[model samples]
Target chain A: MNRYGLKEKIELRINHATHHIEVDVRDTLLDALRDQLGLTGTKRGCDMGECGACTVLMDGKPINSCMLLAVDVMGRNIMTIEGLAQDELHPIQQAFVENGAVQCGFCTPGMILTAKAFLDHCSNPTDDDVRQAISGNLCRCTGYRKIVEAILDAASRLRRGKRHV
Target chain B: MKTFEYITPETIDEALELLGEGAQILAGGTDLLGEMKRGLATPKRLINLKGIQGLADIRSIPDGFLTIGSLATLSHLAEHPLVAQHYPLLIEALQRTASPQIRNIATVGGNLCQRPRCWYYRHSAFPCIRKHGEGCFAMGGQDRYHAIFGGHRCFIVHPSDLAPALMALDAEVRIAHADDSRIVPLTDFFVGPRDSLTQENILTRQEILTAIRIPVPPDNAYGTYLKVSERKATDFALASVAVSIAWLDTQVTHARVVLGGVAPVPWRVKQVEEMLIGDELSGKRIERACERAVDDATPLRHNRYKVALVKGLLRKALHAAHRSREKGEK
Candidate 1:
């Protein structure tokens, strides 16, 4: 057993793009996305899955990226914060901005991704539902009131089927 | 995290063959990865079972059993229409589990097989009795979350929210070895602290849990799962209760009361179940049963509050079951 570690080349389909990178067998998806692929938008807070800052979409469902190995996600559709915006800000991001949901901006990417997944499945969610949906992602700033408002606002805008910049 | 050889096995036989002394089965990697990162588990090889086919399906098998594959994630199980229709107790427990992100990846088998979240056992510095150390630190240390029942030498409480609900529903699990497999009741799968100090479940290092089999609930049966935790998401239960009862014309025909976060295993109160089998769930009857639920609980220093907490949960659960029976709710 080599002490330094063993590396394997694997292809990851992240954010609708395929990238083949050499990663250590022990490297988590969060590590690979940040270090190798330079997708630093996904933050890593409390890598033990307690904090959802490293959350990303795995097959249209939110999952903590830090708890999964880089090699584990092969041939699966993975979407991150970067995939939501094509030319302008996505509706969720716009709602977050308009509602002042972002204070430190550290948890923005993960919060947006989590809200996006929740709003995709539940179109008419109550305030309690949005609060429960984003319980995993923690923001020390904003006290979560604005985050809740942003998600509810985003849900209404999404129900209208309009993409606002 | 330490470097290890990771292999994705495409078959159950291949996965079992690869398991050995220094190997660990990786399912969902929600709990196992955390242990690896904390240096609590240092395996040389990781057998990733996600590549196996037919291990993540949720379908009805023969013999009126709805068999849930071991690899089925909690989110999928909670969102399954059949699960919601057949067993809402399971859905209630699953929704109150970790969080949406964790439920999306945490497997049902992995949830049942997860180690205790006891602070003493988790920290490497303590080396408590569960970790093969000399003595249990929680016995004399901070024991706010320790077990109030079934504590022999260790005081750690079982952390899984799904086990109690499954036990109440009389679920069975299939464990697979190299060439053979056996089905065991979900109640028998757990190992109490008195029986074994090192392991929580009866699964050997090589055996892998394959599927969970739940019989279709009987008609006129009402069940509910109630949990009390510090926070709504990403929190372990302080005290929880799962009650499944069947009544015909306001008389109890069957009852199963299982309590969690108060014992080393999901504490099944046959005493309370027997008390409710022949009588109706009236307010006085429920109060007596709730008091009987904690008669044998020997609380540690800081967890005496758990006795009252668990009793409160039992009262609420029984009341819910009572209301469901009255309204003819399935």
Candidate 2:
């Protein structure tokens, strides 16, 4: 049964299309991004906040949507794992797929989005920066060395493209 | 999580008016919501303070202070130009708190006003005194993260990196009551476990922290917050110190030594401050000050190592602050 006082289906633009879905303030953004929108790219490994499998960009910064309320994100530019690209994969996403960063595939989306946020702000981040950027996202499948490499690789590739243009 | 009545007021007075019965303020739901999720905190109403106007802006006052709205998230603290230039220790402390993801939504007021993160307090099974019960099991149970000072009855640390740094920076907290407003220094903001085992800070029920005001950094002042933790981020400091040191050339003009992970409040070392002042801030003098920092530490059975760890952290903080001072105002 729908919970009482669940506000009439709030209109949220996911990816490119707009959809009307009912949600309570208690329901998290991760719940709507996955359960309602059917965009399961954002994984839900640990419902508890420990694991960052459900990280997403809210207003262009990385946040654990599992810990954020969907109702609170009204008018904010909410970008998800699915919103990272449309016609093609995000360069970071492609790097993840190519560099074998996707082990169990549970943490790939959050990792790629987090990397995008980092590189978008810092074109050239040191090892400490890279470590700090993705400290929230955990991947038990493959050691973090590969994930770090892909992000650094993608960052350089993007910078080179900017120069050539 | 239990469903409660939700009210998002746009004005501070309106939000304060909605208080009387059973309502909890929700600001950047980093801590309050966590309590509700575990059924640890179940107010009859949930007051969303995010939509409240004028509570998220950051600006400076002509009186040599920077005012941070209660709703200003930790991310804002790290990125705001005034905070970055005037209070680097505050920024470093926020960086020491959770990761970038969590910091994006965690508010500084909530961080300072956060409830105890003790396993006993969070878990429902434990009848912890922190949860308004008879005794705190952490005294004999798993207490690796318990307190080292002011724990005559209960031994829980403050658990926020920003609090210690604010204390060192001589910040003041402003709160809005039902009819009036009052301000207090950062050190006086905390209430010890012995004082009120149920509350973390000294905010009244209807009162809400409207803003935190940090004074302008002292001339020749250099500040740094050093936290040692199990992980890079998203973990509380095992032993953290926010050290602010100022000097003309060799002799110390002022020094603020605030320690976290060692007590209920931001434990300041008076003797440590005494040992450093009027003396050259060389490595030798700094070492002597560091030893004096933990002279009064009386750790329990398990937390004995915290004394040495805190001392080491203080030395690192002094050197870091000294290094930052080398590049003075330009």
Candidate 3:
């Protein structure tokens, strides 16, 4: 059904790499990232904005890629979970691993990315702040106690200027 | 989602020229894209409004009104310092919206223009009246979350949290067309199913909402918004109330009580407002005033809880406003 529209060619910088792709106007950023660009780290849970599994950093702000049109993000910097780690895991990711915050690991990438953005603004957050910050990202496996601890631990590590991945 | 032609216009004039039949305006795309994916809306052309500049600014004129662009995202509005200090009701409502990620992408205009969350209307499988079907399934089907105040033929409840708060604050929306521009009260923006089942709002196909103008409240005005959702987070409200009351020493001088998730539009209860005026908001007076809010409610089969829920929410919201006024006095 999507084969009949006018395909538009747009260029976007995804994960610090530039790619030019032709996409239908109806194609969402989530579909373009996974199908066209082969960046499957961003999971599509509900395909709607109800789930945050498709959360990605659009121009340094976390947004749901599933709800955003790919053409709307043209010339903007797009960062997915694939861009979170360089040579090793980022601090928030390392904390998630150490704190055993991964149950099925489906919500890990989105959770860690959201944590990274939240921590960048607020390095000192209380338990309630952490809970409210990650309220958008749903985790069905863990009861979120450990996930909150992981984010708090990541904030502490970042405050100490610990560059260990 | 159905394939459609997309146009990103750079100016308001260009956008207005491009907007017409068979074209849908795309703001943050949080609501529009979801509706398209669910097959509820099928447009041949999609007009992306993000490219237009000056549509997302939140500016407050000195000692005058606060103008919030319609394209401003919920996250931005929730975090703005001026909004937090001046319009806490909007902040509270925006914070309790869909979720963090959705709020980051959902625009204020899009939130106010979102369609009803009725299961039958949303699902393409069922032919509902809103979609030009023969009958409304919720009229006789399961309508636990339907409206109790303004259910005529369709029983869908308005899904926006900000609309109620805006209406309570007496906000005005700025609409732009190709030939002219006009301002409309936020209260008159939404239309009922009885008025026109095909459209939920008064906005026509050729007009675009540009900004929201909120006049500065009186110095003694205190406002609060309370929502009772099924879940603590990321759920639509079962019943919600936004109350703004002006205090003269201790007596209530003016009040605006608006309810959400309980009607086709932002339900404003003038009887409750009139009852509260010229009287001190004591516990007994608040209880009595809240009871009057549901005097005209006509509940459906399963939504009788909403009548009681609205009363409780109204009472809680008034008490909150009273508390805020006390704090301000101190």
Q: What share of the true interface contacts does each candidate keep?
A: 0.72, 0.45, 0.68
Off by over 4 Å in 3: A1-5, A162-165
Record all residue pairs in model 2 with backbone atoms less than 3 Å apart, i.e. clashing.
A9-A21, B98-B234
- Chain B TM per candidate, please? 0.98, 0.96, 0.97
Model 2: share of real contacts kept: 0.45
lDDT of 3 by residue, B1-330 (tens): 778888888888988988788988989988888789988889988888888889999999886899999999999999899887788889889988999988888999998899889889988899988999978888778989999988888888999999999999999999999889999999889999889988889899999999999998877888888999987788999999998999889889989999999998889999999999998889999999988999999998899999998988888888887787778741
Task: Score residue B157 of candidate 2 by CA lDDT.
Answer: 87
Q: Where is model 2 more than 4 Å wrong at Cα?
A: A1-8, A163-165, B321-330
Summarize candidate 1's per-residue lDDT along A1-165 as a digit string, tens digits: 111247888899998889999999899999999999999999989999988999999999899999998888878888989899989899899999999988999888989999999888899899999989888898868559988999999999888875443
List lDDT for all candidates, in order: 0.91, 0.82, 0.88
lDDT (0-100) at residue B49 of candidate 2? 84
Candidate 1 displacement at residue B142 in angstroms = 0.2
| Stretch of 10 with least lDDT, candidate 1 chain A | A1-10
Docking quality of model 2: it rates as acceptable
lDDT of 2 at A143: 62
Every model's DockQ, to 2 decimals?
0.55, 0.43, 0.53
* Model 1 CA deviation exceeding 4 Å by range: A1-5, A163-165
